[model samples]
Target chain A: MTMPSVSDSGLATDAAEGSVVLERVTRAFQGRRVLNEISLHIAAGEFVALLGMSGSGKSTLLRALAGLDEEVEGEGLIRVPTARSVLFQDSRLLPWESVLDNITLGLDGPDPAQAGRQALASVGLAGRESAWPGQLSGGEQQRVALARSLVRRPQLLLADEPFGALDALTRLKMHALLRALVGRLRPTVILVTHDVDEALALASRVLVLGNGRIADDFRLDLDHPRHSDDPRLVGYRQRLLITLGVTESA
Target chain B: MSAEGSTLGGRITSSTPRTAQASSRPGGTRLVPRRLTPLGRLLGPLVLLALWELAAQTGLLSPKLLAAPSTALITGYDMLANGTLLPHWLASAWRAWWGLGIGVAAAVLLALASGLTRIGEASIDSLVQIKRAIPTLALIPLAILWLGIGETMKIALIAGSVFVPVYINTHAAIKGIDIRHVELARTLGLGKAVFIRRIVLPGALPGFFTGLRLSVTSCWASLVVLEQINTTQGIGYLMNRARDYGQTEIIVVGLVIYMVLGLASDAAVRAIERSTLRYRKVIGS
Candidate 1:
């Protein structure tokens, strides 16, 4: 199935150097192709959301880009900068280490603690360096994870259903924090999620993957901190839902 | 899942949620304070002692078979006064201590090699399995022949007894490390030394502690058989002497010392567990 291409209205494509470029990337597992002949160019500072059904190769593509899944069959040229970081569904904090130590983990600097503190403060966890990961709530642990990722100041950030485990209210609040942080950092980001609203709420450009390829690309030129109730997001939401093969009723 | 969850600090999206709780201080790894002891624990031992005393006083139990608590206490005091118990107690303690030291060292080294390296595991694991099957006390005859029924034979017996438990526990602990944590180390590009220091050692500590407790008990248990290896020193020697004279009170005294030593070592391990594993308690009740 193929999606009809929409006009790229108000989408700025001038003088933006590509930070990540994928050329004919294909991945297969035991004779079954998951991602096939995928190609894309993500400019610096652009936030892209990858929307797809389960097993549609969204995560496989993401992992391939991270240089983790190198078993691709074809000449798939994936160019990612040295400065990059990834966040998973769970916070994945080292339970043994304190909050601050987790942030400064693997980070080399004259004063990693100070840098971790600043990162924690940015995530609204100013004095929580000494607390264990188990002490914090789920959301707070994710915040520490965010601080750990941002502590390195990576140029590219990849997220895979980070808020899939969070509640609606927490998810909304996290959206705001993420938008604020991204606006400040100006790094290119590729967010992979099954949640269409999340993509519409965050991504400047949303790509829908189907049959191991990008089925549709929707460019939302909305302002920052877009709400779920905004009329501008309604059309994109409907299109995404239909593309994801969700029926109105069973 | 956000890219921030990646240990490698790879590509991530900034669109994830941030409703994380920043303040619940639940699972801190601070030193945990000891809780109050329940009365039930002391009650059991006291009741057992009282039952023995009652039976002895009523003559329902013969003194030859089992000495009364009062008789044992009086014998212990008399031996203490005459300085007969001190030398035996000292010798037993020394043997147990050295056996534990040597066994623990060898076990840890072998466990580390077996746990971390395939070659080490392949070479040492089968041999250890064979050693584990044979009770260390069964080697008494061989040990006596090799080391001449002196301090060497007794110490070797205790060491051999402790080795298997220590090795099994330590090796199992090392192998039982969570795969995710190892992935985290690799993603972080941690060096071998740093990985061993930061991940391997701390991860295997609880297992090692468990093994240490077992080693202590086994070492003490073996000391009984070891000191009997034609030795004229230690509590075992004292027991043999009492046996020759048929002085059951002195024998009872020696038995009580061994019991106390076993309990003391067990308590020491518990204390270490409480301090080192305090982090596990930090989770909200």
Candidate 2:
């Protein structure tokens, strides 16, 4: 298989610090290849959105980057930061634990509680420390999940459809919150999502997976606060949608 | 019928105003009545007792067959006054406590073994299932042969019966813990001890409580049977002696004590369950 190398256009100075480099990474399940000898590179502090159909290996790729697929049968090298966190579709908070406890779970430091409180405040949820996870709204639970991820001060943030379960309005609010948090934290993020607009809205670079490989990789240089109505974004959206096998008549 | 339908429709359309008026009223009444109050629960038993007393007084109920409630109460009072009931009650209670304690401890240990490890499950689960098919009461003859009809034999039988439910439920609960949570623990880099304490233990608690409730009832049940065998100390012995002398009132007293103890212990376990699992969105709470 001829390996195609996907690289960032610029920002290579701090490449060794928080950058991701995959060299012909391949993953298989039950003798069926999911990620087939794919090579890619992501620069430090880049927000990369991964778009794919249901079985297009977006989550498989993300899981590989998160070191979650160690037991998975794969042949290749995935270089991601040791300090990384994953945000799942569901909040995945332990219901038995309080909000602060969920955030501070497995966190070791002089005062993890203080860091947890700060993380909670950053997610706009202060003073909800003692509340149970079940008591929180769906959006609030996701926010707590975001807090838990950020509390680790990860260099890489891997999110698999974090806003997938939220209501449309809540999803919009979360997009804004995530954008702001990412702006401040500056982690190299790889978000796996099915929503094209979500990818364009938050990510600096978007990659579409098809046929167990990177079918299309687009560097979205479009500025932040990029609206679906924006002509440039509309252009990108149309192209990305067509690539994703969607054809809109209008 | 059309006119009545129109009237009902009118009422339905005016429901908003009616609801507003209801809300505006001081100390608004509940739309749904509470399931049961303390007094309400006692009413059925009280009425039954009243009927029984009336029947006995009217000579409809034969006193030789079964004692009247008043006769049984007087008999119980006399036993308490003469200190006979206390010793017997203490002996029964002691046996029950020991059996339950030993059984529960063994159940927890076995459940942990089977639930946490594949090897333990492979080794222990099949044996327990086999034992479950054999009734503890049926083992009395064998137990007497082994332990010689002493307090040890009685307690061993009670413990043997009590262990099954607790083990089954706790093991099931441990196995039933969400796989996602275990994966979450792995991602969080939680150590084995931390994982067990935070995830496994709390996850199994509801199951353990369920098992405990069954075990509490089983303790009293087995104790009742165990006391009847070659024993002169427990409530079963008292009942057995009363049966020989044809003291129907004393027998009734023994039955009443067992009933109260069973109810009390179940209530205690439920109270503990309620407090510990208050986070659950329980229906009818």
Candidate 3:
């Protein structure tokens, strides 16, 4: 089968070589350019992490990928236009909805309730179909978000540090959960994160961004659900540290 | 603070003993435990009553001139017994209910209309905010001139006064919906109705209920003012008539009844809101 192409909103796709090819995408807010000139290409089913310091254009890149913010002036080619979903860093659960309803916010299809339940089950929240997002812990809300994106089974997934705010242990577990989901679902995911280990743990391809450009694209050949400190990944982590220009912060 | 805490703890721990003692009394008590929050609310009222009764006993306040808690309670009961109080209270409640209901319904409809479209929102927001700022009490003169001194005019005035709150709250509620949620709905192809029903209304509900409670309070307050017109009944009419008869106790009694009604209506709406949005606390969303 040909490699899938993901949409701008992180839906799965069948676009072969350059599913997302940004030549020189730039975004400026009130004459201050947030993204100066970002050119990158994301392949199909690629778990690519955009890692950078705060305000280093990683989220700006992800936003451009998600099509959430089109305020930037740029040249970009994004395949698979629809069937996409974005998991915000905030979890953004509908306050009034049950976990299942939050996963499927509004179903515009044949049977949304059933689909929503299935989505809930996909993220290991099977028994919490009737549970409200408020009742759930912070971890559980993020899991609902994971389920939402999983439900779409899109060509791409845009996650802006989806587990950035989680506790150390929860974030570790969520990393595993996300890796498992991406492997099984195979949606081309673009995660904007600041954690180098997280990038190594969750993503197959880690793109370190700085000064509004892809500074380095590190490919980790390790399989899904890898440990945080895998031996082969250790060297890659060191390389990422160098790429991000962090002086012994690791 | 320590004493208060200890007293609270004592109440919690001695509940069984108290209930058992009550059961053994000459008139056996049917004891039902109440939650602390509600019990806590009653403490202030009870303290005020105790102070009033003490003042009356010391003759610092004349029971005839300024009825104490006990005297007022008796007077209130007397009015209740002679069938004068119930009708007046009930009539005021009825008019206030209609005014609040009609006002809130209109507000919700207008909010939905305005919130869904920029043109509707823009056209109304400027004028509505301006009109809202103009005290509804000031409009009583104009309302009377236009609608005449009748029950119709009273209800209309009350409704008009309350509408601004409900409208503003509803509109704000609609505005508070997360833009991401709206985008999610659009991506899913949910039409206007489904989007409004599932996302917009629920998102706006908390604010809407807050506005609604405020509106009901205003409506009831306005009902008192509105009924100052050619009405033979209602709490306002009761107070006005008492003033004419030089019955200071009855006038005080009527005003107290209005206050109680306002408190009760607000409490009821709060209870409704708690049940409706219980899931918010549940999911931590």
Candidate 4:
């Protein structure tokens, strides 16, 4: 194994207005506490991935950011009173609508028609505006979902294992697309996933959630659009695997 | 990812291409897929007609009781050409159309109000359920007593026929939309105007069209029952008069025309729905 470059710790602090601040955010369902006083801060315009086992509170935390679950509390002073969008685990495309309309679902302006077109083009779905949701494959539907969150051009982007359903290769492509999009749009993104390699290849900081709290937080200090084969990524991958107690590179 | 083949990290998946292909055969032209659906739909009606004609010609059915398809078709045109059938059809069309328009408008207002408020929904659900279960046919005596045996009575009859289907369908569509989409609109900071105009209406449209389609068909068919009791000039009146005179050919003609008109109206509405939805979702800007 080879050591890789770690650039200066010049975080994109100014790009995002309000960094995510989670302070003792506790969530309970019925009587069972799903998340117990989980507190963390994700910097502005920085890519962060929350890695955890299924049923862990990783998705719950992400949903809280999206304000989907307002029941969770004690999340302190969020900066940049800015817009946010959430990408779901399932693509959740309206079954009857076309891919184009799905992307433009929440967008509003005097000219949504133009915005929808431009967003479709950005996601490389330029010619598929009229294609029905059922007509698109799983990967394409996921891409449309990505386009959906992107169409908002949100300051805070929350994703709940958005690529968990895609094939590995498609996931990789989506990761790259997401990386490029974040690089260009500079939206502060918090991605929740069970895939360690994905965390290494994409996020600048990786946090693991265990027993309803942050078990580990490791800053990669990697560049935007980092390669999957980056030597630093290889080391990080191994470390994540040992932490998760698995050797498979999946 | 290029649009050609490879996408998402070299994963190749087929993009649905709405294309036309050509086949090689005698006088083979470019094999633009014919819209066979429209033609295929005609088979059921045609087969029924064939069977009916066969039954009538074989004397298995009495001419006084059942007219052959051929004679019925000819006599239908004969009546229409001479304007003997026009007044009846026109009258039925007027009552059905107006009653349906009023029913739909009122139902839409009610559904919207009920769906938007918990109190309204609770208050109306029981009432609507009770009203829905009460057979509209049983209301005829009351209708005559209140509105008399006039146009108002007939219109009431028509309204009673079509209201439940439209109202139920509209309400169901409103309830069926995913809650997530509703939140999406809210976070976007759109005012109530844009939200209802764009999100709520389109989301409810498929079901709304579904209700409208069924009710319209019912409107056309149920008018005959309405016409039989009171007013004159409608397919029902024509059918009744033909029965009285033993004019089975005229009765059959009226029946066939009514069926054809109902079918044509349904097809027209369906086309409108498809075209509107397609235009709304038109891809590639």
Among all candidates shown, the one with the greatest lDDT: 2
Kindly indicate the candidate among 3 and 4 with the higher DockQ. 3
Among incorrect, acceptable, medium and high, the docking class of model 2 is acceptable
The residue-level lDDT of candidate 1 at B202 comes to 78
Poorest lDDT segment (10 consecutive residues) of candidate 4 chain A: A2-11
Docking quality band of candidate 4, CAPRI definitions: incorrect
Backbone clashes in model 2 = 0
What are the per-residue Cα lDDT tens digits for candidate 4 across B98-159? Answer: 88888888778777767767987998767877889988878888988999988888877678
Give the CA lDDT, 0 to 100, for residue B112 in model 4. Answer: 73
Tens-place lDDT per residue, model 1, A11-92, is: 1222234388777766777656787778888888889999999999999887776555533443355677666777778887
lDDT for A81 (candidate 1): 68
Give all TM-scores, in the order shown: 0.84, 0.88, 0.82, 0.80
**Top candidate by DockQ:** 2
Q: Per-residue lDDT of A154-235 in model 4, one digit per residue for the tens?
A: 8888888899899989898888888878889998888899988888888888988877777778999877657778888888
Q: Candidates' lDDT values, in order?
A: 0.80, 0.88, 0.77, 0.76
Q: Between candidates 2 and 4, which one is better according to TM-score?
A: 2
Question: Candidate 1, residues B1-285: lDDT per residue as tens digits?
Answer: 565568344433333333453666845555987553777559888998999999999999888777888998999999899987788888888998999999899999999999999999999989999999997777877877889867888778788888888889989999998876675565555688878877788778888988998877767777665666667778877877788887787788888988888888989997888777665663332
Better of 1 and 4 by lDDT: 1
- Please give, for every candidate in the order listed, the TM-score of chain B alone compared with the true chain B: 0.83, 0.87, 0.81, 0.81
Worst ten in a row by lDDT for model 4 chain B = B12-21
